[model samples]
Target: MSEENTPTSKSTDINERHRVRMERKKEIVDDKIQQAQRKAGVIVITTGNGKGKSSSGFGMVIRAMGNDMKVGVVQFIKGAMSTGEEKFLHRFPDEVSIHAMGEGYTWNTQNRERDMEKAEAAWAKSKEYLSDPSIGLVLLDELNIALKYHYLDVHKVIADLQARPPMQHVVITGRGALPELIAVADTVTEMQEVKHAFKSGIGAQAGVEW
Candidate 1:
């Protein structure tokens, strides 16, 4: 074969091009990182039809705890059943405060008035955490579901969230997050349902789905 068209030469050329591309990408990423000098806390929203929204929020709770920060969690529509995150985070009484206030899902409860009452109670607890500067991060788990059902007023929630401590972060998780919440959030992640194991024959497993 000719030297110009050799397989080894082509491989080397491709590798060199990849290296150059990655180097440029690294520089751009590094520049962005350096340019981000703001130290204020952020609002993060995890929503959509897929699962893992509350899981992601709890992961941040653990992350914040790892940094020696206090966290408060209010589970809006999950008090009927215990969860792994709740069980685990409850172990840290000083670092974490968890309130699972909901009676259950709306369908199971079948009472709008009761659901609204529970939601209001949960919101009151969440607001306490939001106002506390000592609480570094607040997780409003499954709050979007309550908002979607109109158990709580979206505008009031948004206004209270806006008034939270400047350096206290917040995470709201559930399917169908409101556009108003998304607009004000610094980070918004939507977990789209591509496929689910439960749709097959598998049931909700321990540690994974709980």
Candidate 2:
């Protein structure tokens, strides 16, 4: 047909439209990037009754380590089993400090006094990490569980979290995160449990569920 109506011309027109759309998107995204000028560490909470909450926290720990930042981790209710993250990060002792302070899950431990004692001990360790300016990221693994069961005072936990160094990032992970905690955090992510393997016949898998 005519040169203007050729198949190649139609393809060229589509490409031009796509390029124009992307150009606008790039400008909008660049403007947003520019608007976010303030730089500081933030409190992040990953909560809800789903998997990957702690995994996501560990992912950020790895990210911090990749950036050459020192990381500290305290397991609140997960010392019953050796997690995959703990095993892997143990090799990088210089970069990541791990403290599995939990006495085990609450149901298994079945002692409120012991659980409270362990929670307090864990918080004591966490305060050290929070106070140290050298640690760039601190992960309080399953901390929400302890807070939920009133093993530790939520108000005090939040106060300590707030008192951390301005440049020290924190990640708290577990189900039933307190509303007070969420209110103070800079970022919050709730994992929705659509399905779980334990609900079926499958058991927790190493590297995948640990």
RMSD of every candidate to native, in Å, equals 1.4, 2.0
lDDT of 2 by residue, 1-210 (tens): 899899999999999999999999999999999999888889999998888999999999999999999999999988878778888999998999988875778888889899999999999999999999999999999999999999999999989988999999999999999999999999999999999888998987888887
Q: Please name the candidate that would achieve the greatest TM-score relative to the true structure.
A: 1
What are the per-residue Cα lDDT tens digits for candidate 1 across 1-210? 889689999999999999999999999999999999899889999999998898999999989999999999999988787888888887899999989975878889999999999999999999999999999999999999999999999999999999999999999999999998899899999999999999999999999988
> Please, what is the whole-model Cα lDDT of each candidate in the order they appear?
0.93, 0.93
Residue 99 of model 1: what lDDT? 91
Please provide TM-scores, in order, for all candidate models, with all chains considered together.
Answer: 0.94, 0.92
Native-to-model Cα distance after best TM-score fit, residue 169 in candidate 1, in Å: 0.6
Off by over 4 Å in 2: 1-14
**Total clashes, candidate 1?**
0
Alpha-carbon deviation at 22 in model 1, angstroms: 0.7
